[model samples]
Target: MSRAEPKTRPSDPRFSSGPAAKRPGWSAKSLELPSLGRSHRAPLARGRIAHAIELTRTLLEIPADYRIAIVPGSDTGAVEMAMWSLLGPRGVDVLAWEHFGGLWIKDIVDQLRLEDVRVLVGAGDIRHRLTMVDWQRDVVFTWNGTATGTCVPGADWIEYDRQGLAICDATSAIFGEPIPVSKLDVIAFSWQKCLGGEAAHGVLVLSPKAVERLLSYTPPWPMPKLFRMKDSAGLLPGLFSGNTINTVSLLCVEDAIDSMEWAISIGGLSALHQRVRDNYQVVADWVAASPWADFLEAVEPCRSRTSVCLRISDPKIAGLDVAGQHRFTSEIAQRLDNMGAAFDISGFRTAPPSLRIWCGPTVETNNLKALMPWLDWAFAEQELHLHQHS
Candidate 1:
C-alpha cells in the first residue's frame, strides 16, 4: 500500500542542482546595492566586482599568484574560452562522464576540429580510469559530474609535474567541496551553484602555466570578444582586475557579493563545507534506511555531496528499461513537486532516470531531513499510480 502522506515538508523546497537555494536568511533587500543602477565599469560597480574576486580568492584559498577573473557566459563560457585559446598547441585528452563533459568533447573535436584528441568516456556514474589518461597532453575534465552524480576521488590521479594543463569545470563543486587549486591549471565555476547567486557570469582561475600559454599561443579561429583573453600587448591584466570583457549584470554581481558575505559571516569555507556535510548526511541517512532507493553513483566516495543523485533500487522498478524507468521516476518527482514537498528533484534530461537533490551549503539540513519522508511517500504513491494505470 502507498505510504501515508509525509507529516513534514522542506521549508524552502528548491533542490535543483543549479541556481540552488539562497542562504537561510537571504532577502531581495539584501541586494540593494550602491552599484546596482550604475554602469558596471563605474567606480562603485567595478569596486564591487573587484571585491567579489577577492572574496572568491579568500573563500577558495587560491594561491597568491593565481590570476582570477569574472568572465561572461557563466561556467560554459569560461571552459570554452580556455579550450579555444590554449588547445591547438598540443594533443588533448578530454574526459566525458556526464552532460557538461560531453559538451567539452564536442568543442574540442567538432568545433575546434582538432584531430589529435582522445575522448575517455565513463558513462553513468562510473569513473574513467585516470591511469588511462595521458597527462603529457592538455587535459580537460569536470571536477564534479553534475548530471552523473560522480566526481574524481581527488587530485591524486592527476600528474603533479605534468607538461600539460589541467582545465577543470568545477561548476557544482568549489564552495561546498574542497578543491586543491594548486593541482589545476585552469578552473571554471559559476556563482549560481553553491553560492545560490544569480547567473550569466563565471569565475575563471588561471595558474602561472595557463598565463604562459595565453602569452605564448593564440587560437587561429576568430576569438569572440567573450573568448579573447589577451591582445597584442600581453595577457589582459584588466580582466583579472575589475574590467570585464563586456557588460555584466550589476544585479547578479550584487547577489553574488551578498551570498559570499553571508558565507563569510558563517565562518567562511569551513562553515559552508559543514553545511554541505550536514545536509548530505540527512540524505545519506534516508537512503540508508530506504528499501526503495540507492545512490546513482554507487561508489561512496564518488558520490557528490552537493548534487546528490539517487536511483530506484526496488527490483520491480529497476527492471524496467531506461525510458520506462524515467517515466516512472519523473512521476514520482512531479508528485513531490505538486505537493510542494520538493521542486526540480528529477534527474537531468540526458542522464539516467533518478532524483537529483541539491544538498549544497545554502540548503538547510532540516529541510532535507523533512524532505526524506516525502520522497518515500512520493515513491510509494508513484508505485500505486503505475499499478492503477496498468
Candidate 2:
C-alpha cells in the first residue's frame, strides 16, 4: 500500500508521536456547548475552561495554591512563556538528553541571549547530567524526551532547597509518570500528548515561586501580549479560575476533562503510571527477544516509560555503517507503514536512526503485540529486497 492509501482506521493502533490515542469513550458530543460558536469571552467558554482546570488539578493532584492556565500554541508556547518570563532573573542551567531539552538549551543560550547560562548534555542513552551545577541557578529540562525514549526518573534530581526554580516540560510524561509537585516550579504541557486532546492549547502550572518570578522580575526584552502572564495577575483570580485569553474548542476542553476524569476514576496518577509501565514492558520484551532490537536508552532505569525507542542490531546492518543502517531502518519503517502495521515509528530526524514507539496510557498493549510481528516481517522483507538488489 502507498502512503495515499487509507491503511488503518482510527480504531487501528494509533502510534503517532503526538496527538496520541484518546481515552476510551471520550467524545466531543459530551462537551458540546451552545456557546461553542460564540466569543471566548462568553460565559460558557469560561465555564468549560474552569471545569478543565479543576479536573486537571484533581487528576494530577496539583497543589491547592498553584495556578493552571490554558495558553496558546501548545507545549512550545508553555515552555517559551516560562523561559521568557522566568529565566532572566537568575542564572540558568539547561539539562538536555534529546530534542526537546536541546530546544530549551538553545532558547536560553542563544534565543534569550542570556549571559549566565550553562547547558549539560548527555550522549547516547544517558539522561542529562545534573551533577556539579550550582543549585542557585534556574533549571530547565524535559521530563521525557519523546524522540529518544528516555526520561528523568523524578524531580529528586532537582535541588529542592535551592534558591533556583525548576521548570519542567512534561508534555509527554505528565499524566504517564509520577512528578513530585513540590520539586517543580513551572510545569508546562500540551493537550495533544498523553492527554490525547486537540492541539493549539497548552496547560501551564505555576508554583508559588514561579508566580513570584513573573510578578517581580521582567526579562530585558519586551514580552508579547500573548506571552504576558502578569496582566492576568489581578484578573488571574478569574483567569486561573475561569477566564481564558482566546476561545478554546469546548469539545476539546470537554474531551480533556473527560480524559482527566477517566484517569481519576481508573486510579489517578498511579494507574496512569502503571499503564505506561505496562506498555513499556511490551516493547521491552520485544527488544529482549530480537537480536536486532535493543533500547536506545543506555540505562534501563532512566529509560522512558512513555516513549520506547529501539535500534536495529542485525550484524549485516551494523557492518554497513551508520548511513546504511539509517537507510535500512527508513526502508523498514516505510514497509511497516505500507503494510498497515505501524505509523510514525521512524526515529526523529535529529535523533540517531532507530525505531521510536510511544507507550503512553491510551496505547493498547495488544497493539504493541500486533506490531512486533509486523516489525519482524518488514525487516525480513527489507533484507530479502537488499539481497535481490545486490
Q: Point to the candidate with the largest lDDT.
A: 1
RMSD of every prediction: 1.3, 3.4
At residue 306, give the lDDT of candidate 2: 87
Error of 2 at 227 (Å): 0.6
- Model 1, poorest ten-residue lDDT window? 122-131
* Candidate 2 ranges with C-alpha deviation above 4 Å: 1-11, 27-35, 124-128, 232-237
Query: In candidate 2, what residue range of length 10 has the lowest lDDT sum?
Result: 1-10
> Candidate 1's residue-wise lDDT over 1-390, tens digit each?
667897888899999898999988999987857787799879888998899899888888899899999999999989988898889888999987789999999999999999899998854434455778888899999988889788788788888898999999999999988888898999999999999988899999999999999999977888888898898899776899789989999889889988998999889999999999999999998888899999998888778899999999999899988998999989999999999999999999998899999999999999998998898888888898888887
In candidate 1, position 83 carries an lDDT of 93
Global lDDT of each candidate: 0.89, 0.81
Residue 338 C-alpha lDDT in model 1: 96
Tell me the deviation in Å of residue 365 in model 2.
Answer: 1.6
